[model samples]
Target: MVAIDANEVSKRYGTLQAVDRVDLTVEEGETFGFLGPNGAGKSTFINMLLDFVKPSHGSVSLFGNDCQGEGVAARSRIGVLPEGYSTFDRLTGRQHVEYAIRSKAADDDPIDVLDRVGIREAADRKASGYSKGMAQRLVLGMALVGEPDLLLLDEPTTGLDPNGAAEIREILREENERGATVFFSSHILEQVEAVCDRVAILQDGELVALDTIEGLRETMGGGTKLVITLDRLEDGTLETIWAVEGVDTAVATEESTVEITCTNDAKMDVIVALHEAGLDVLNFRTEEASLEDMFVEYTGAGR
Candidate 1:
């Protein structure tokens, strides 16, 4: 069964359009990433999927159930670590997990769940005294209570240290292995790249790009980049570099460095051209575009 399906879904508030018409679908057991800049309507779209915010137009469904018309049934199949979730300050860590267990009618032990989230030692500590990271982990533990079919995590690593973030990644892998689909949205591009099978990039309330990392690189063209530091750059140096048959783009940096995007086969040609132009090659290296790189390219957020 499809884990999520949205057709021409959109949301508007007053004169602002938060999410434009967007069509998206995720397969069962898939690890999908949703990305967008601040105020780009990512959260609005997610809230629509949860039926927390009604759409201005179009429809969305969860596991074949219309989220708007059947909100409870749709929610039953998903576990969400929502953005800006509040923990009950009067409850202890264990109490929170136990509440979720009871709410889901699951037989999971609260202590076991707390231990799995690395908060076993603080199970009796009131949430009012928990650190931000601790509170984050508590909510994640609550989400894991019943082993729901879909895990919708929004900025799951927000306050985590490196070790804590790594632990979350491991937990996600474990859940996906156990047949749960993961719909992850985060600003941490590296973490998303580490686990997601495919990613969709949103901009200005529109779906701008959707593909696997490599597929995005291919679609963007010249996935390989060459950073060449030269002794000095003369006039038309960039144009000379761009003249190379396979080069897609060439730009001269402030420090006499030339950045070029070209096919892997064109790497050597760029260097030879610099030498032929009488510019001494100081240093050069090739790197494939990272998710962060593509995110910048797609969203125009880089400066």
Candidate 2:
């Protein structure tokens, strides 16, 4: 079964098209990433999926049930850590997880959920006294109740420290391994890159790019990094490499290595060119473009 299906989905407010005709499908058990800048309609799209915001046009279905028409049926086994989630001022961490357990009719231990999100020690503290990061963890713990079949997280790492973020990523990995379909939405490229099987990029409320990270890199001019280790280097060696047909940029990084950004087809040609120039090639490798590179090229965010 398709985990999520959004067909020509659109949401408009006044003169603004918050989401414009986005067509997307996420297969069951797939870890999918949804990325966009702030106000790129990511949250709006998510709201539509959860039936919290009605789509102005089109339809969305979850597990073969129309999200808006059959809200409870569509979302029964789904868990969500929504954007702008807040903790109740009086509820302790344990109480929040317990509430989710009760809501889901699950038998999960509250302390176990708190421990998984790395806040077991603070489980007894009132959420009002928790820091921003702690509150984020509390919500995530709530989302993990019932061993949900689908996890829809919006900016899951918001307000987390580096260690806390790492913990969340690890938890996501565990969730996916246990057969849950993870629909992760965040602007933190690295987090998405770490766990997502495929990613879709939205820009200005339109779907601009959708593919695996490597696939997106290929679309964006083969942003591959080629590093060549030579027996020695000379002043004109880099200039010679830059003159190659597919080499984009070449720089001497060390006494014996030249790192080049070039097309995928140029990697071997670069080594051949160096050998022809009386240089002994010792080692060479190519690294695919970073997710950040793809994000910048496609969305022009953080440019």
Candidate 3:
């Protein structure tokens, strides 16, 4: 089932276009990542989908119904963890979530939802006293309380530590397994690569790329980087290294180190050639190009 669909959605602010013509569809039971650099219109596009911001052109549909035409009926079936969500400072975490559920008229147990987000112990603490990460968790807990069919998370792990980030990823994975579509936006390319089934990359308010993680890697020319440590520097090393058919580029370092970048299929060939060059190679290791590098190459920025 198509949980979310945006066709030729366009949003503009005066003369500047925030979200240019774009098309996106998220299937049920999949984690679809909306990826882009800052000011790339990711949040604007998401806001249009949520009907928080109306589009200048085109339309957005949720669960086969037009999102913009409805009176919160479609919205009731979806939950959102919006970017920069703020809660009442005086209210405790538990109260915040319960209040959201009540306001939404959702039928769910707030306690169980809070526990699922690993914020049970902090539920009694005031929102003003919560850490940045904890505040994020509380809002997410509120989003889950509705048990909606789809979840829209914008930079959901921005304030989380490594462990909290991993925990949230796992929870989203479990939610996907249980048949909820997760439409998420994040500047963290590695997180998208690790958790998302498919991704759409926007640049300068335009959809520049869309595909599976592996497919995007292929499109970006997947490669492995090799860093070789030598016992001592050698003369004519650059020329000798370039002699290997598959070595794309090589840079020699002052500390007797050379770094070679090549495709995966060409790595072993380059390694063997390095061994035969009469150079005392102390050690060698291969580093693969991560999704982060691919994102930078495509989006022209990193977060």
Candidate 4:
């Protein structure tokens, strides 16, 4: 079953087109990541998915139910940790979790939820006194109430420290293992790369790329960077290496070393070509493009 579906989804706010026409589908039990720079319509698209904001054009569905027409039923089956969710100042963390449990009609123990998020020690503390990280954890625990079939987390690690972030990643993994589909949205490419089964990159309010991590690297022309150390460079060495099919770029970075960027399938060809050219293959190391590298290439944001 398709867990979430959006067809030509778009939203405009007066002069601003917050989300351009976009189509997306997430399969059941998949951990999907939504990525984009600020103002790229990620939050807007999420809002449309929750029916928090109406799209100017297009349609969305959750678990085969129309989001707009079946808003309550759709939401009832999902847990959401929205961007900048507000908490009642007077409510304790435990109270917050309990409230979510009650709202969902879920038979959940608030204490267990707090323990799962590693905030049990602060369970009795009023949200007004909670630190940003503690508050973030509290909300996350609330989202875990009843183990909903789907999770929509937007910037879930926003205020977490490194340890807290790691804990969240672990929780996401555990949740996925338990057969829940997770929709994660965040700017932290590393976190998304750590947990997502597949990712979609948004640019200028449109879907620019969508694939598995390695697939995205391939789509963006990101390949293995092979740096070879040589005893000495012979004349025409660079030309000879570049002539190898699938070798995108080859340049001498130093008198004794050359860097070649090429498809993974071409690494051996590059080595063979260099050897055939009478250059000793002293030593070679490869560096794979990280998700961040592909993210920058696709969104043009890191530049």
In TM-score terms, which candidate is top? Answer: 1
lDDT of 4 by residue, 122-193 (tens): 989899999888888999999999989999999999889999999999999999999999998999999999
Q: Between candidates 1 and 2, which one is better according to TM-score? A: 1
lDDT of 1 by residue, 221-258 (tens): 75787889999988868878878877766766667887
lDDT of each: 0.89, 0.88, 0.81, 0.88
Off by over 4 Å in 4: 226-285
Estimate the Cα RMSD of every predicted model relative to the unseen true structure: 3.1, 5.3, 4.5, 5.1
Question: Considering only N, C-alpha and C atoms within 3 Å, which residue pairs clash in candidate 2?
Answer: none
Model 2 lDDT, residue 221, Cα = 69
Higher lDDT: candidate 1 or 3?
Answer: 1
- Could you arrange the candidates by TM-score from highest to lowest? 1, 4, 2, 3
With candidate 1 superimposed using the best TM-score fit, by how many Å does residue 199's alpha carbon deviate from the native? 0.6
Name the lDDT of candidate 2.
0.88
Q: What are the runs in model 3 whose C-alpha is more than 4 Å off?
A: 225-287, 301-303
Q: Of the candidates shown, which would achieve the greatest lDDT relative to the real structure?
A: 1
